[model samples]
Target chain A: AQTVTQSQPEMSVQEAETVTLSCTYDTSESDYYLFWYKQPPSRQMILVIRQEAYKQQNATENRFSVNFQKAAKSFSLKISDSQLGDAAMYFCAYNANNAGNMLTFGGGTRLMVKP
Target chain B: DVKVTQSSRYLVKRTGEKVFLECVQDMDHENMFWYRQDPGLGLRLIYFSYDVKMKEKGDIPEGYSVSREKKERFSLILESASTNQTSMYLCASRYPGPYNEQFFGPGTRLTVL
Candidate 1:
């Protein structure tokens, strides 16, 4: 079984600043996927970024990027030029290649972007 | 754009009542999933379906049953609702592939009193 852990329960960042949310997972499979999802209050959950284990380069989408360290089993999300809209609950998820698309998620980190 | 929609955004029911949560996807995705979300606990999979009429138990399937009579719709049922079952239920769907991301619904917040 794969387990994702987000040690930080909550994180705060000033608007226009940068913030990094930590995530770690336990999985024996070499082929897997990692993702970060964001859910705002009373809003739908949306994908923030994703990283493929085989890809050494991190994934980035606008202000969101991931620091994927396969050897350390760590995948962290970094938000640059953070905006108020970035304030949401962020989740780190793992899905092994053979896991049939079922994702194991971490406890989640609540991000607060202060103005 | 892919869209996953749940039947209701909010629901209230009493203990022992039968509860049904419906999920529909417009993209004709072969995979659908049901998950429960609670504070401090990101999201726990309850059930998932890979195809029509095929359902699989997830990490926490206890007290929950699912039906997937069609490829685009998946239903989650609580035969006897309990207070412990009160939580935000989320529905997601994705294509059967390694790199595709799952699309999520707005979620249904159920309260069992």
Candidate 2:
């Protein structure tokens, strides 16, 4: 079974500053997928970024990027130029190579963007 | 744009009563999923369907059942509601591919009294 763990329960960042959310997972599979999702008060799970285990190069979407350390089993999300709208609950998820794309999510980290 | 919609935004059910949560997606996705969100407990999968009339148990399937009569619709049923079942329910849909970007519904907050 694959499990994702987010060590930080909560974090705060000033607007326009950068923040990094840490995530680690336990999986025996050699190939898998990792994702970061954001859920605001609206409770909509929005995809932030994604990384494939086979790709050593990190994934980036505008201001959002991932630092994927496959050997270390760590995938961290870096949010640059944080905005007030960035305040939300962030989740790190894992999916095995053969699984049905069903995600195993972390406990989540609540991010607060300060003005 | 893909859209996933739930039947309700908020629901209150009594203990021992039956509860049904409906989810519909317009993107013709081959997969649909139901998950429960709890404080400090991320999103836990309850059930999922790969096709019409096909349902699979997820991490936490106890006390929950699902039905998929149509390709675009998936329903989560609680045979007997319990206080422990009170939580936010989310529905998501995604295509069957390596690049899985699921579209999520607004979620239904179910409260068991």
Candidate 3:
């Protein structure tokens, strides 16, 4: 059983600044996928970024990037040039390359952007 | 663009009443999933279907049942609605392979009183 943990329950960042949300997971599988999802007040979950465990380089998408440390079992999401629209509940998810196709999600970190 | 649609955005039901939540996908995905989201619990899978009439129990399937009569549509049923079952229900669909992204619906917020 894989478990993802987001230690920070709430995080706030000023507009145009940068913010980082921490995430850690426990998994024995060598190859897996890590994902960061954002949920606004609308309750719609949207994909932010993804990182493959096998890849040594971090993944970057627009202003969203991930600091993936496979050895430390840490995958953190970094949002650069944060905007008001970035305010939401961010979740870290883990999925193994198997038949289950089920995603294990972290508790979530609520991000707030201050103008 | 993949689109998953849930039947209702919000629903209210009484205790012991039978409740049915419907979901439909337009991408012709072979896998559909039902999940419940609580305040602090993130999201928990309730049920999933790989094919028509082929359903599997997820992590939490105690008071929930599902039906996939057709490939595009999947339905979740609460035989006896309880107050504890009130939460935001989400429906998602994806292809039948590993590492594929699952498309999600807008979600239905159910309230059992």
Q: Model 3 segments beyond 4 Å from truth?
A: none
User: Candidate 2 clashing pairs?
Assistant: none
Error of 2 at B14 (Å): 0.3
Name the weakest run of 10 consecutive residues (lDDT summed) in model 1 chain A.
Answer: A94-103
List DockQ for all candidates: 0.79, 0.71, 0.62
Query: Which residues of candidate 2, in runs, are more than 4 Å off?
Result: none
Q: Please identify which of the two predictions, 1 or 3, would achieve the higher lDDT against the true structure.
A: 1
lDDT of 2 by residue, A22-91 (tens): 9999999988889999999886789999998999899999999999999899999999999999999999
> Pairing residues by index, what is the TM-score of model 2?
0.98
Candidate 3 lDDT by residue in tens digits, B12-36: 9999999999999998899999999
Best by lDDT: 1
- Evaluated at residue A1, the lDDT of candidate 2 is 83
Worst 10 residues of 3 chain B by lDDT: B95-104
Candidate 3 chain A, poorest ten consecutive residues by summed lDDT: A96-105
Cα deviation in Å at residue A113, candidate 2?
Answer: 0.5
Write one digit per residue (lDDT tens) for candidate 1, span B1-113. 88899999999999999999999999989999999999888899999999999989999999999999989899999999999999999999999976689999999999999
Look at candidate 1 and tell me the lDDT of residue B113: 100
Q: CA lDDT of A6 in candidate 1?
A: 98
